[model samples]
Target: MKKSYCPIDTFINVVKGKRKATIILHLFQGDKRYNELAKLLPDISERMLTKQLKELEEDGIIDRKAYPEVPPRVEYSLTDLGKEIHPYLKGMFRGGILFEKRIDESL
Candidate 1:
């Protein structure tokens, strides 16, 4: 992760990539194979999903395991660091809902 003057900036730096936070949130529920993640995040292009997963792995937020098989088996799970950040991310999720509700009400 990139060093920053503020802790929040450092946190943001790790999760700034496309769908990074969403991927973490999904993984927080349980370990998931690559195809399952792809299905969960249909809006993201395959290339972008691959890129984000790689970045999250590099950041030590997720663990990637591969198994030797005919088709290849790979699973992704959150690391301790990733689990540690879940509460904070969940708070952000709740905050987003609040804002979205306000926006809907305003319309």
Candidate 2:
């Protein structure tokens, strides 16, 4: 991740990708396979999901383990850094809910 003067900017830069935060949230629940994540996030295209996962791995937020099997199995789980950021992400999730509620109420 690029260094930023503000810590918040650094944090935002780490997760600034389509469904990246959502993917982390799901992985926070437990280790998940590629297909499991795909099911959890139906709106994201396979290509986008793959890209996001690769980026997250590169950023040291998530670990991808590949198992040698007939079809090849891969699982994703949060790294120590990823777990450390959970509360912050959770707070953002809550804030998003609040804004969404306001939007719905206004409509």
**TM-score for each model:** 0.96, 0.97
Candidate-wise lDDT, in order: 0.95, 0.97
Quote model 2's TM-score: 0.97
lDDT of 2 by residue, 19-83 (tens): 99999999999999999999999999999999999999999999999999989999999999999
Reference-based lDDT, residue 70, model 1: 82
**lDDT score, candidate 1:** 0.95
Q: Candidate 1: where are CA atoms >4 Å away? A: none
Q: Which runs of model 2 end up more than 4 angstroms from their true locations?
A: none
Global local distance difference test of model 2: 0.97
Native RMSD of candidate 1 (Å): 0.8
Q: Candidate 2, clashing residue pairs?
A: none
